[model samples]
Target: MNKNQDYEIFPDKFRIIMTGTTFAFFAIAIGAITLLRTNFVWKILAVIFAVLFMIAAVRIFKELWVKTPAYVINATGVTDNTQKVPVVVPWAEMMKIEMVPNNAVMQIGILAQKTVTSQTEKTHVLTKNLFTNGNMAFYSVMIDGFKYSKKHFLAIFEELQRQGVQHNPKILVSGYNVGREK
Candidate 1:
């Protein structure tokens, strides 16, 4: 695909399937909880789990219903359309692109000249605590194995590097096994 051309990334089928399974499991759990023997603590726990599970299911359903592109890449920059307020990262603001290894999964980290802003920025911080070790405010894009294999993601990453270089010769692009320590 041409780097200058716009491309829309959709969520993987595996994610949708897993989300459906989770919703079904939670729905069943709610039913099972009502049938459990009398126990105050168990009932309280059930209520908490029910609420959390329902929220998760609703969020997943909303994502499925919206059918919006997860990410958009073009000549100007990359836009994350998945957030409440899409984040537009201009090419000049992109400092570096690194592939960070995490629990056998690799994520593409887009380091920016300054912190990127989004409506869900705070949510990113909370989720980052689970996936990253550093405190930097770069944007992280997870490549779903079911949607795009590792090789495919790497290719896109390389293309992004090429685009960045074409747009801004000084921008640093690394982490494609070049052995530059992070």
Candidate 2:
């Protein structure tokens, strides 16, 4: 593909839907089972947990209904649409691309130039407290439901860097080679 060609990555709706539904189901089961407990504290705690899980499930399922590309990469920059507000990181301002693994989920963190913090001051959920090396980033997309494997995902950015795309930020991938299949 040409350097100017745009690539869009959409979330896997099926996997995400199933996960959301499973969480909802577990929440219901927990709430129901707690009814059998004699302790009031246990019941209250279980109810709270159930509500929180259900809320999370609802949010997760919303992703299934909203059909939008999570990430768009092109010659100009990488646009992250995963958050409420789209974050546009131009290649020149992109300082680093860090692949951080958390709880079996892989999140791609796009660290842009420190000056970009002015844009991140917005009240978006992803714009808060995302500090790395005294730099704030608003781009973090989860790849759990993506179609490509983790290795392929990393390769995409690496290839762009190798091709010497504009600025070509440093790509750092961690916790990917540990017991993970290609």
Candidate 3:
């Protein structure tokens, strides 16, 4: 038996699958929206958004395709195979991890950049992915009335909390969006 088989459990498959399916649905939705709406500006925007959404959906599906069989081994530290962030997070740092509700609200900080008006410097800025999952694992960032079955949200949150507790770390718990709240 593989020594790491214990921690070799898969990531949140349902979320991955749901996200992929939703993106594909969105691709269709935008096309229909454009058809129903007669504004030229809206048409142009819809087509652009649809194309970009399709491309991103394809990319996400491809990544998940290969990552399904992967696992999160937690022998000394937790190594998440499914997520793209730091695969291996030491127990200490993981304990310090906290989720900021409405994280995109932090982007409001960027607007301040306009007021700074720095003319001589450039810095690498990571823009929020407005169209992506909206960081669903922490549901407060979700759009209003966005729905997910209770089981789905419970499963993911519990797993993360389980891991956090197992390694003697703390997990950040936040409220869900109004319509999506348990």
Strongest candidate by lDDT? 1
| Cα lDDT listed for each candidate | 0.64, 0.61, 0.45
CA displacement after TM-score superposition, residue 132 of candidate 2 (Å): 10
Where does candidate 1 clash, by residue pair? none
Evaluated with TM-score, which candidate comes out highest? 1
lDDT of 3 by residue, 27-74 (tens): 879967777848899888888888888887787577555644343435
Ranking by TM-score: 1, 2, 3
Q: What RMSD, rounded to one decimal, does every model reach?
A: 5.4, 4.9, 9.4
Judged by whole-model lDDT over C-alpha atoms, candidate 1 comes out at 0.64
- lDDT of each residue in 87-117, candidate 2, tens digit only: 7777766656655554455555655654235
Q: Model 2 Cα RMSD, Å?
A: 4.9
Candidate 1 local lDDT, 1-182, one digit each (tens): 65457866666555666776688688668747857786878777787787778777777766665567877767887776745667677887877766666555566667666444465865764476344534433454333333355555666677777777887777777664623332
Task: Choose 2 or 3, whichever is better by TM-score.
Answer: 2
lDDT of 3: 0.45
Task: Give the distance in Å from residue 149's predicted Cα in candidate 1 to where it truly belongs.
Answer: 5.3
The positional error of residue 103 in candidate 3, measured at the CA in angstroms, is: 9.0
Indicate the residue-level lDDT of 181 in model 2. 53
